[model samples]
Target: MSALDTDRYHIFGVCTPKDYCLFVDYVIDEIKNHESSLLQRIQETPDPALRVWRESTALQGTDIFEIECVKDRETAQEAVEFWRAYFHSLGETIIEAGHLCDRLD
Candidate 1:
């Protein structure tokens, strides 16, 4: 099993007419597809300096995913193309994003 636990869930919001079911479904699909790659990327890169928070914000009506992940200092630019493809396919907006590492402490 992955060293990570369920408690380390990706926390994000999906607004779909306030319908819990739709929101849940969106989160579920996103978690399934992005979780593995994200975890792997996060793991392969050691220091917290390499962390990035992938975020998406769809407009009240339109369907777009605005994903912004912190650029790896070493890489020198946000991997927008990779993340954009993932989030765009889902029709969600990549609104706000940043980098973060899970700190037990």
Candidate 2:
């Protein structure tokens, strides 16, 4: 597949359930307020760019959230920056963020 077809861009990390709930709530608010273009796109599209799940571990389960899109680099960058800023505004430190091309074929 062409580089343009790659679903490489993603913002992913693990966080506590409390922080995860807070983050999800913030995104839901943005969607309701129509305040974010990236989020609106995800909401409107048949295929979403955001995904969240929980994984059980030896310790307490961790909430993992990933925002990704199979679109152009610029659009992906915008989504990444939007989440980065949002997390920063909430004083939430991202454990990892960036294009995750290497994680796939």
Candidate 3:
């Protein structure tokens, strides 16, 4: 595995209406396909400040899908805020949001 790969998980629980699945998936696909993705941003960050929350980032599950990323705790929090702002700016009402690091149970 590469130096950036890790078993650590940064999981964010995001909620929206069930009807928003298409919209959510669309945005995720756009990110995955484009340069503005979280992974891209982390890769582009200069060293001394460089960080990674996941080897891959995707919005998974149904309307209540959890975004599961990777790496450290601090980076996980940062990732949550990054996505939270991104979705909010797109006019999505984040009626519910939460985040957790690794597995506790």
Candidate 4:
């Protein structure tokens, strides 16, 4: 379990290896393109959406990723929606590419 697991809600998912690679690249580019704005958002929000990506660790040899979020059901739900939007923006669907689950630790 992650250190964040104890106090945070988690959004977990599994995707194709291909999609996982694509997501990593996309997030890298996104950070590059919006560093200043992203940083400002991080500074202003105690639990910014991107915090999950920042705190996550890619499971070696698997397509699973789990995002830890602030321990609020509403915040967890928002993160779930955020990921769904991301998949949609990438021309994918959660059902086709993988699945998402939320839980508090």
lDDT of each: 0.33, 0.39, 0.40, 0.42
Top candidate on lDDT is 4
Best by TM-score: 3
Candidate 3 weakest lDDT stretch, 10 residues: 21-30
Across residues 46-81, which tens digit of lDDT does each residue of candidate 4 receive?
Answer: 443334432452323244455443565567666666
| Candidate 1 stretches greater than 4 Å from native | 1-81
- Put down candidate 2 lDDT per residue, 1-105, tens digits, no spaces: 864465444444335655443232222111222333433332333422233322221112234345544345565556666776787788875434223232221
**TM-score (C-alpha) between model 3 and the true structure:** 0.41
For all predicted structures, in order, the TM-scores are 0.22, 0.38, 0.41, 0.41
| TM match of model 4 to true structure | 0.41
lDDT of 3 at 5: 58
Best of the two (2, 4) by lDDT: 4
Pick the winner on lDDT between candidates 1 and 2.
2
lDDT of 1 by residue, 1-105 (tens): 544322333333333343211121112123334554434533354443322221222223222232332322322122434443455568754433334333311
lDDT for 47 in candidate 4 is 47
Better of 3 and 4 by TM-score: 3
Lowest lDDT 10-residue stretch of candidate 1: 20-29
Clashing pairs in 3: 53-70, 54-70
